[model samples]
Target: MSEEIKVQLTATPGEKPDSQKLGFGKYFTDHMFVMDYHKDKGWHDPRIVPYAPIVMDPAAMVFHYGQAVFEGMKAYLTDSGKVLLFRPDQNMQRLNCSNDRLGIPEIDGDFVIHAIKTLIEIDKSWIPTEKGTSLYIRPFIIATEPCLGVRSSYTYQLIVILSPVGAYYSGGLEPVKINVESDYTRAVRGGIGFAKAAGNYAASIKAQENAKKDGFSQVLWLDAIEKKYIEEVGSMNIFFKIGGKVITPAINGSILKGVTRSSVIALLQEWGVPVEERKLSIDEIFEASQQGLLEEVFGTGTAAVISPVGELHWKEHTMKINEGKIGELSQKLYDTITGLQSGNLPDTRNWTITF
Candidate 1:
């Protein structure tokens, strides 16, 4: 990989969507980062080009074999007009992990970060200054070899696209209701569950759609084998506070190791709050609620940061957490993370990178 990247500006700039109406992943910036890969060339021709449709063969391997992975991150605009990225290095590292699992060639995380910063600088005006609004960056790689054979593709394309997005919650933080899914399994042990592969999400859409029909915001997935132990939500990793201790399911090759999940754990440890990462059962959570030990329940991810779980609907049970309200610790973690991201608070942990 070379440090020199070609830049191509757009001739006609696209109209920027209204910041207030910018929903999640709905709008794009004026430019994007792209780099091609071949078995002989490794990865080359890194360039920042105008945002447009990518021309790929109809018989592309990605359309047949589903060898694709993506990473999600955000760039925040500070009150002082500085642009900050929250733990982008972690996202790049995770992308490589996913690539290894999917048999795709690994990318240079550092160089990719540089490319992303360059792309963001070109489209910096699309970053929203509204509270809780930021520019979302999605970097993905797809198999481009036009072959029907069931094997790894030698040709690939890595593209980074930017989207201006509003906050997950337009108003204040509101706790959401999650439906416990038992029939549909999201992933199994020794599977591609931990990787951020595109197919993993496609498999979860049915359960998520069913849960939404039941009036739930998201589906809480259980382990694929027993379907009893809690795994994660469809879009976020889950956590629970019981008896003054915070517990989340351990990463055992079946759960996606979320960057925000690790950050939340670090924040809890910094505050001297007891936190554990191990196998947690939904029955145990219900029992904790029965014993009045359940204090708070929340989900953590790049999109929402922290989503307090106000209610959980299991079979023949409806557990209302924190009296169906946001807990104190959940609120504190959200404020601290957002404060660091928005440059409102001191960066004691050095979690943000500014350009």
Candidate 2:
């Protein structure tokens, strides 16, 4: 049996129904889970408190140097009135991986899982039941020690917050147009790119904004050293299909090891799709597109699940993939993954943990 954690809830006053109209991450729940760690005391004083503003000193390490990491996952409400978490253990493991890279102390996986379950139980009503809607959970750790020096902090804070989100594709499952960023690099070898650190995302906002301004939805980043191989899209891991085989870039030191990406590879392999985890070059994909052999291209992450890529722009040249429409494989992968998540399909991989 899991020990129940205490919570102090304070509901938000005059909440709006407009959240349904706006999509995900626009609205937050009334409460949040928090825990603190110290060099001498370790993690202590865990609690679920009202969602409120946090005060930090100007010299806080997170403010000065941006030493923070975060994970994105979801909680689903099934038709049977049961709540489920999709592969939370994997997220916990990944969080530790990020912590190790950031020089933050590792946390016990079981404790973190228990904390999440407790928090969700206290805020169950905040979860939406509409199709393509779920509670988005963000778990993050940040260095909070108040100091001006450029080093890791001795004090750390971890928090979990929930947001009710609608479908990522409001206009339906339409594919996206992505611009290949050959000039700017999102991550480099021997860098903190593999971790879910704040700096990695901070460095990407400008590029993403530029891409959006140019009528592209996202930027597909290439390797830093050679700027040849494909790495990932803005916040998701990318996948390509050529000649009926699924190929994604290998998990080099620079690429983030997304849970959704790993799960997709596992699901595809189980369905007899030849999945390759190796270096995939932009040149190869462009050649395949020119030869009319590129069948599909999509990105995977917790936020969008699997977003199809309709077009690719590389260095003043643009190529349309699958005639600028969603591919069959993309739809199949989305349906299968969403089905399993929504409890409409069999939980073959035992990916869901019920509450």
Among these predictions, the greatest TM-score belongs to 1
How do the predictions measure up, each by TM-score?
0.99, 0.97
Candidate 2 local lDDT, 1-355, one digit each (tens) = 2334568878653263454574878888888898888999888888899888888888889988888999999998888877888899999898999999999889877888888888888888888887788889999999999998887899999999988899899777889999999778899989998999899999999999999999999999999988889999998999999999999999999999998899999989988999999999999999998898899999999989999999999997788999999999899989988888888887978899888
Q: What's the number of clashes in each of the models?
A: 0, 0
lDDT of 1 by residue, 1-355 (tens): 6759999999999999998999899999999999999999899999999999999999999999999999999999888888899999899999999999999999999999999999999999999989989999999999999999999999999999999999999987999999999899888888999999999999999999999899999999999888889999877999999999999999999899999999999999999999999999989999999999999999999999999999999998999999999999999999999999999998988789999
Top lDDT hit: 1
Candidate 2, superposed: residue stretches over 4 Å from native: 1-4, 11-16
Clashing pairs in 2: none
